[model samples]
Target: MNASKFGAEYALSDDMAEFPAGHTGAFEVPYPRSCCCSSGDADLLEAARTMREALQEVWLVMDALGAYQSDDDRLSILHSPKFSSAAYRVRTAMIKTQRVAI
Candidate 1:
């Protein structure tokens, strides 16, 4: 399935339709069954691209939270080394996924 279809299938709630801000809700990534059954390189590439889009959404949520909580000392975890590392890792994975070739 394509990214929009995949997203619609797994969208958390109506509230999440608002983009980065509303994405504060719980997020889940349901593995696509096509990846297990299909051997085509194109299928694999599509799956990779779908996953990359999901990662981008996740990055956007984190970015929104980081910006929203930029001043609150109690929410400083958003600025912590561990959080930064995790965000960096997600971005690296996004780049890798984008490079997948058919």
Candidate 2:
């Protein structure tokens, strides 16, 4: 949950739907997500679609975080408005901790 873990195999859980026949990421998959296909005709295109959608969602969330540091030398986060709630919270906490320690 904290960015260390990823991948289809890590997603298998009780909440996950039953995997399609021969599709085993770890155990269950609602449709098809596993790369391991014993089936003669594995329409990985379905899995690709799923992956694409998930990636798009991640792109939007990361973009909102202002996580990207552009290469342009002139652009500066220092002059930018606070970009995300997460950043703001962490910054505030760090400042408070420093003040308390002093």
Which candidate number maximizes lDDT?
1
Which runs of model 2 end up more than 4 angstroms from their true locations? 1-42, 67-102
Per-residue CA lDDT of model 1 for 36-73, tens digit only, reads 44565765666566667657656655675654454574
Which residue pairs show backbone clashes in model 1?
none
Error of 1 at 16 (Å): 54
C-alpha RMSD for every candidate: 21.9, 21.5
lDDT values for all models: 0.62, 0.47
Say which candidate scores most in TM-score.
1
Where is model 1 poorest over a 10-residue stretch in terms of lDDT? 1-10
Off by over 4 Å in 1: 1-36, 41-70
Error of 1 at 13 (Å): 57
